[model samples]
Each structure stands twice: as C-alpha cells, then as structure tokens.
Target: MSDLKTEADSLNRAGIKLSYAADPLNHPLADFKSASHDLSAFGVLGSLLKATGEVREGMTELADVVTALHDEWQAEGKAMLDVGKVLDQVDRLLQESLARKHG
Candidate 1:
C-alpha cells in the first residue's frame, strides 16, 4: 500500500511538471484547465486519505467544481480564438476581392 501511494504521488508530480512544459505557447487558462484536471484526482484521494487517516491534508469539494468551470471556460476561449482567426481571414479575402473588382 505504501508503495502504491508513493507511485501515485510521483505520477501526480510528473503530471504537474508536464503541464508547464508548454508554457511558451499555451494560454494561462489552458494551464488552469490542465491543473484543475490533474489535481482533480485529489478529490477522490481526499476521501480515502481521511478514511484511512493517512494524512489530514486533501482537496476541497469546491476544487472539482472549479475544475469543471475552468474546462468550460477554456473551451469557450478556444472557440472564440478560432472564430476570430476565421473572421480575419474572411475579411482579408473580401477586401482583396473588392480591390480586384474596382481596380
């Protein structure tokens, strides 16, 4: 059991490190989304730890809720970025077509 717990902790730490590896290109909200999802496992581990009295530390129930919100907001932000890019391309194309027609 101790070995299992140790491995779990190592994996959790690894996940956190991996999340930040893309810091150059990733949005802050993307990191928030990744962190929320990664740390969510604590929601389950929190109960188990309390039941076993392994440690008095654990995540709050609100963590999961916040994570859910982050996920939704990240998706929305990505969609908006995509829409903005497409709109810019379309506007450029229209301008080019009008210029060609008149000139």
Candidate 2:
C-alpha cells in the first residue's frame, strides 16, 4: 500500500509537470482574460479529479487543456512565462488535497 501510494503520488506529480510544460504560453498571457479562463478550467477539472483521486481523469483533463492552449498559442503567435506558476499551483493543490484526505 505504501509503494502504491508513492507510485501514484509520483505519477501525479509527473502528470502535472508534463501538463504544465505543454501549456502554449510558457509565459504569462498578455491578455490575462484568456489566461484566467484557462486557469479556471484547470482549477475546476483539478478539483473534480482531486475530489475522487481519479488519476486517469485528471491526466486526461490536464492533457486536453494543454492541447487546447497549445493550439491557442500557435494561433496567437506568442510565448508565455506562466507555466511554472500553473504547475506549482497544481502541485500545491494536489498535495494539499492528499493531506486533507489523510488528516
């Protein structure tokens, strides 16, 4: 059980890292509105996934968001620096959620 938990946690972190890396604007979006929308969607899907600890669903949602944003980035022809913040948020949120579960 311990090993399983460890593996799952590692996978979750990796998924978050990959998803963050895939974000179209690796930087802050100059037009913050679109970025806010992206982050909101991420937060909601993340909450859903965390509530159930459904790793697959979480990964899928993260992947979809990144893909969509990647497309959007290409369309807009811009780079971003906000990827680290987003990934950090995910890591913090996921860890906090797990902590809540254990407590």
lDDT of 2 by residue, 1-103 (tens): 3444455455555545554554555444334423433433435665564544444455556656866876664443322224334445666777788999999
Worst 10 residues of 2 by lDDT: 75-84
* Alpha-carbon RMSD, each predicted model: 18.9, 21.4
TM-score on alpha carbons, each prediction: 0.43, 0.26
Q: What tens-digit string does per-residue lDDT give for candidate 1 at 1-103?
A: 3343454455445545444444443465455545544544445755654443322122333444555665665555555555545555666676788889999
Off by over 4 Å in 2: 1-53, 78-103
- Provide the clashing-pair count of each candidate structure: 0, 6
